[model samples]
Target: MSESKRMDPFTGEKVEVDGVYENEAGQEEELHRGDAFPADLILGNTEWKLTEMSFDNHHEGRTDERLVPKEKDIDKQGKIDSPRRQMDRGKK
Candidate 1:
């Protein structure tokens, strides 16, 4: 007989279901967005186990902005040494 493979819940792709992995705290470790299919079977007390695998195009839903939450806003005012900050004391 042949065994059927299950799909990954997050990616909706066919994946091979394996045994559960644990962590130091005995809690289940979460899979990140960029995590690859057929995750590594990590052993610890947190119960982190590689559940399944995913397709190549799994991160279609994630937005570019989401990947980089915030960026340094450019200063449009220019440098402080510019004429803007200089006081016109001579005119007074």
Candidate 2:
């Protein structure tokens, strides 16, 4: 049998391909290209492996600003405001 393509993706990493990914716990998630891998609430960070490729041709390889990663915003204090940090701003 041919070797299966395996990916080493971590939480917060950009999804390089549109496909179904399986984590170490055997949990599967369908992620589109350019989307960030989400952290597992219970397991925290886990490695992801691409299991299946998506054949959807709706976009036809077109790039979307909403789907791609954005530049980090810097606050007045010169601190980079990441998505997680922005969400935690009011908690502190």
Candidate 3:
């Protein structure tokens, strides 16, 4: 029999596979491969365990925002502020 895959990723850690992860509080989040685990606002940093693997075979070359590290100058609303936005602001 094949062994079941187990993954327990912490906040700021890179996810090894695309899947759904659950925290100690039972909250779930879907994280893609190569994306960093996020920290909970109320719980701060917590360990996350993989609950399911992605069955998606489609690869459209798109990645979620979690691919970027949390320290990369995201806005208060958790949106990434791209360099293009800076240039646009300068033009105003």
Q: How close is every model to the real structure, measured as TM-score?
A: 0.17, 0.53, 0.53
Estimate, for each residue in 1-92, the C-alpha lDDT of model 2 and write its tens digit. Answer: 34566548898899999999988888999999899988888898988988989876546667654444456633333433355544354555
How many clashing residue pairs are found in candidate 3? 0
Candidate 1 lDDT, 17-92, residue by residue in tens? 4334233434444444544333333531122336444444547856454334244636533334355665568655
Cα lDDT of candidate 1 equals: 0.40
Model 2: which ten-residue window has the lowest total lDDT? 73-82
The models' CA-based lDDT, in order, is 0.40, 0.78, 0.78
User: Which pairs clash in the backbone of model 2?
Assistant: none
Ranked by lDDT, the better of candidates 1 and 2 is 2
Off by more than 4 A, model 1: 1-30, 33-45, 57-92
Misplaced by over 4 Å in model 2 are 1-7, 57-92
